[model samples]
Target chain A: MAWVWFHRFGSPPHFYRLATRLTPWFAWPAALLCLAGLIGGLVLAPPDYQQGDGFRIIYVHAPAAWLSLMVYVVMATSAAVGLIWRMTVAYAVSASCAVIGASFTALALATGMLWGRPMWGTYWEWDPRLTSELLLLFLYLGYLGLRNSIDDVGRADRASAVLAIVGVVNVPIIHYSVIWWNSLHQAPSVMKFGRPTMPAAMLVPLLLMLAGFTAYFVALLLIRARGELLRRERNAHWTAEAAGATATG
Target chain B: MSEQRVGFAAAAAALIARDLRLALRRSGDTLQPLGFFLVVTALFPLALDPQLSLLRDIAPAALWVGALLSSLLALDLLFREDAQDGTLEQLALCGLPFQGLLLAKTAVHWLLTGLPLVLIAPLAATALGAPYEAMPGILAAVLLGTLALSLIGAVGAGLTMSLKRNGSLLALLVLPLAAPVLIFGARATALAIAGEPLAAPLYLLAAFTVLSATLAPWALAAAVRIGLE
Candidate 1:
């Protein structure tokens, strides 16, 4: 029974319909939550005793960092699924993930640098998290570059899938090694996840922002994957019928 | 099954031997990257302050980076000739295990490109005024790091084998993945230059080498097959 549903979901036309139907469920809530979270975080959350309101960048920075890593995992998992199952929908989802992941990583880095300026007295530190995030951006670019360079879509999918899987395995290793390297150098940096000691007022808005960002990712992923599926399967009978119906409706 | 396994091993050995012979015959292929490594290292003193102390401070990382870039110079050619001549297809069709063949090929590439870099790294370090005490540490780190680099490079080379403009693309694909190696290798050498214990970074480099060796051949084989298809 589950296998039947799995295959049905794996079908491009069926997945396209499902994504189109699901996008709104994610998009509206994401927009509202983001609005609330931003207002709550920027205006209502108490300033830190030591860092003052400069730490407020955490509301955007933390969520973007979290989303960047989350999106890469999604991309890698979907790539692996596509490789193992040969599912076109999975490949489409993975392809959609790369751009979104890259943007979030760039956001994380930019916000991180901005936050670092006043807090650490420098815009850049060779801190572990910052360095690894930069590396993550490179990984995303490499994935996109590999995919774009290949002419055949299927070949590109397979090649990039292999790269993603290999990269997924390395991500943790890279993170840990960078941490280890930073410790060896012992550079004082602004970002550290040493403890969960945030007050409730701050924590709540941060949590809301995280949730909102995740929802935003899902909504964006669905919309992008739908377009990818439609374009890739444009000549298929179901796609043509679906396009015609949408056009007439 | 045992007989087939033996045959596979023999075939893999032959492949390695053939690659080594070819690399030796075209000594330019082996020598060019080493020359490039030497030139890059030599350029550092001329480009930067030629003060011995400053040179010594930067030598470990400079040598390592030079080695890395030079290794990349050879990686694009690792499978290029075979791929162009249809030897890759023949190897794919052969009853031998693709993973073993790939491992053997990677090993040969390391021997040609990586080993010479390891051998000459100390000389490069000496030329840059790096302390002689660090030579052993530099040797150990470069040996393991370059092996890991070759293994990792094989995957990139396989992926880009079918492309015409693969030189920069191969470096782009492989360099980020090779970051940990550069960190550990240069750190280990730097510690040795400082006359400090080098156990931690060396251990990490060893672990990286073992990990890359175990996993990369399969990925390389997969990439090669995709390229062939």
Candidate 2:
């Protein structure tokens, strides 16, 4: 029974149909939660004693930052699964992940910069976390570039998988090295997400935003993965049947 | 058992010797990275203040970056020539462990490019106004750093071997991964120049080098297999 379920999950046609079915389930909740979280965070939560109204940026920035890291781990994990099991669906998921991951990484960096300008009096600093995030963006670009440059789908899948795996392994190493180098240079300290406590007003919305963003990512991933599957399995009979059904209905 | 060990060593030695001979025949290719390194170091002083104090301050970073970029110069060619000429395929199909062959090729890269970089780092360091005391530390750091670079570069080279024009793509794939080496390498050089204790950075570098040495061959071998597929 388990083996049968596994095969169904790995099958591209089945996965494509399932993804299409499930996307709305994620998308509607994502919209509702994000709306509620925004209102709760921006309107209901009291301004910070220190940062005041500016602290609300964390609602967007922290979730973007969280998604950036989370997406890469998901990307790398799917890439590994694709490589190990030779599953087309897993490769599709991995391929769909890069652009989204890169976008959130950019969002995180942009929002962090916006927050930094007034808070740190500069748009940029080589703070360790920021530096590592910048490097993570580069890694995503590298993965995407490698994928696009390779013309063959299977070849590209395996090649980019190798890179994604390598990048994942090095992410922590790069993070620590930046920290160590920053300490050695003894630059002015930048703010960290190491706040000791947050009141319920602030914390609740942030948690909701995080969950909302995750659902949003799933919705987007499922839609993108369905497209990837269609392209990869264009010749398969299910695609033609699915296309015909959609065209007729 | 002893004879099998000897045979394995002999096979690796032969592989290294063959690559060295090929590199020597293309002596211009062998010399290009070193020349590029020297020119890059020279550009810093030309562009920046010629003041010795200022140059000394930026010397560690400048030299480290120079070495890092120069090492990249030779990397794209690491597997391309053999891969194009069918040598890489032949070695893969030869029934001996492909991982060992990958390691040998990486060793050859270090010997031709990395070792010379380590030897000439002092000249580059001195040109940048780094003090005499920093030479030993600079050499040690470059030696470890470049070996790690070669190992890391092999994975990149293997991954990109199938692509016809992979120069910039290869760097893109490798640079972020090489960040730790640059950080630790530059820090050690700074410590050496400042006459401060340099043990921590050096240990960290050594640890990174050892880690890469252990795992890179497996990754390189896997990448080569996928490239060929």
Candidate 3:
């Protein structure tokens, strides 16, 4: 009985039914959290003493950077699951992950460039973090490219899985490359190994924003997965039956 | 080749020699990448300040980047010709494991494409006015690194060999995956010439090559098998 959840989740029909039931639960809370976080972030979070109003960009930028990595890890894990379990649902979850992660990475880069214009006095820097972030975007693109270039769905999943697993090694390398070398980027601050660099006043909003961003990503990922699953499972009778049930329900 | 008579080394060498002869026959294919190498490197001096010191400064990265871009220029040939002519089917039918076949392909690539790049690199290094001390490191890094690239690229090429429009698609797939090699090789050359510790970057490059050599062929063979399926 306890393992039934896994058995249910593993079935396409069961997963679709589960997704349908879970959608609004994720959707409403994610929306509410995002709206509240946005308002609280914009109005309540204190301005950085150094950068003033410009540092407001952190409310969005930090979360995007965080999601950029979070999505990659999720995708890689899903890919790992797909490889080990030979599960098509796992592949769909990862495929959806690529779309969402690439968007987050692009947003992070764009927001960083905007932040740079005001804070760093330049739109671009050959800085380590910036360069590595840019590379992350390329890695995502390469993953998608590997998928599209292969016509067979199974082979595409396996090939891109290999690419994702290999590319994750770059994530730590990208993070530490700055600290390890002479990168123009700043060293790790509040997120350092020790205690938070900033007091709770600042930390609270950042934490809230992280929660908001993660919920938002979960909501988006589920929707995207549902769509991809539908497409991939179209020829299967489970999809037809699920569609019939949804129509009646 | 009986079980007791034929060893792995002998088999690998024979396969490597076979591929080398094939590549040597219509070796105009080899010259394409060499030309691309020269022309792309030609752009760097034109685009950047060609002051002798400046050229010397960026020479390592430019060399590594040029090699990367050019090595990939001919990567589609890694399995395309064989797959198209039914030779891949024959090779697959051969008793030799795909890993051995993949290793042989990389060796022949080193001889045909990568070897010429090494020969021409001294000329390019001089033309760019890189310090004399950097020359040995540059050549060594490119040679080792490009061998690794050929091996990795073969995996991608084998996967896409049967797909239509493999040429451009091959570049798209292989180049991004090969980024670390370019970065590591270029940095290794630069640091060594600057009287820095050669051990670290050299070890990293070697690890990358060793890992790629050990792992990429099995993946390539799996990819080829999947493609055939």
Give the candidates in order of lDDT, highest first: 2, 1, 3
Root-mean-square deviation of every model: 2.5, 2.5, 3.5
Kindly report which residue stretches of model 1 are placed more than 4 angstroms away from their true locations once superposed: A193-195, A245-249, B1-6
Interface RMSD (Å), each candidate? 0.8, 0.8, 2.9
Error of 3 at A157 (Å): 2.8
lDDT for A220 (candidate 1): 98
Worst 10 residues of 3 chain B by lDDT: B165-174
- A1-249 per-residue lDDT for model 2 (tens digits): 769988999998889889989999999999999999999999999998888898899999999999999999999999999999999999999999999999999999999999998889999988887899999999998998899889998889998888888888899899989988888677756565636688888888998999999999999999999888888896898997756556554
Clash tally for model 3: 0
Task: Write candidate 3's Cα lDDT for A1-249 as tens digits.
Answer: 898877667777777777778877877876777677777767877776777767667778888989999999999998878877877778888888998899999999998888888766788855665667887888888788778877777788877786677667556754554344433225443212113566565666666777888888887887788777887786888886765666554
Candidate 2 residue spans exceeding 4 A from truth: A187-190, A245-249, B1-6
Model 1: what TM-score?
0.96
lDDT of 1 by residue, B1-229 (tens): 3544448878888898898888889897679999999999999899889999898788877888998899899888888889999999999888778888888899998888899998999899899987888889999999999999999999999999998765478888999999999999989988888899999999999999999989998899999999998
TM-score of chain B of each: 0.94, 0.95, 0.89
Question: Worst 10-residue stretch by lDDT in candidate 1 chain A?
Answer: A187-196
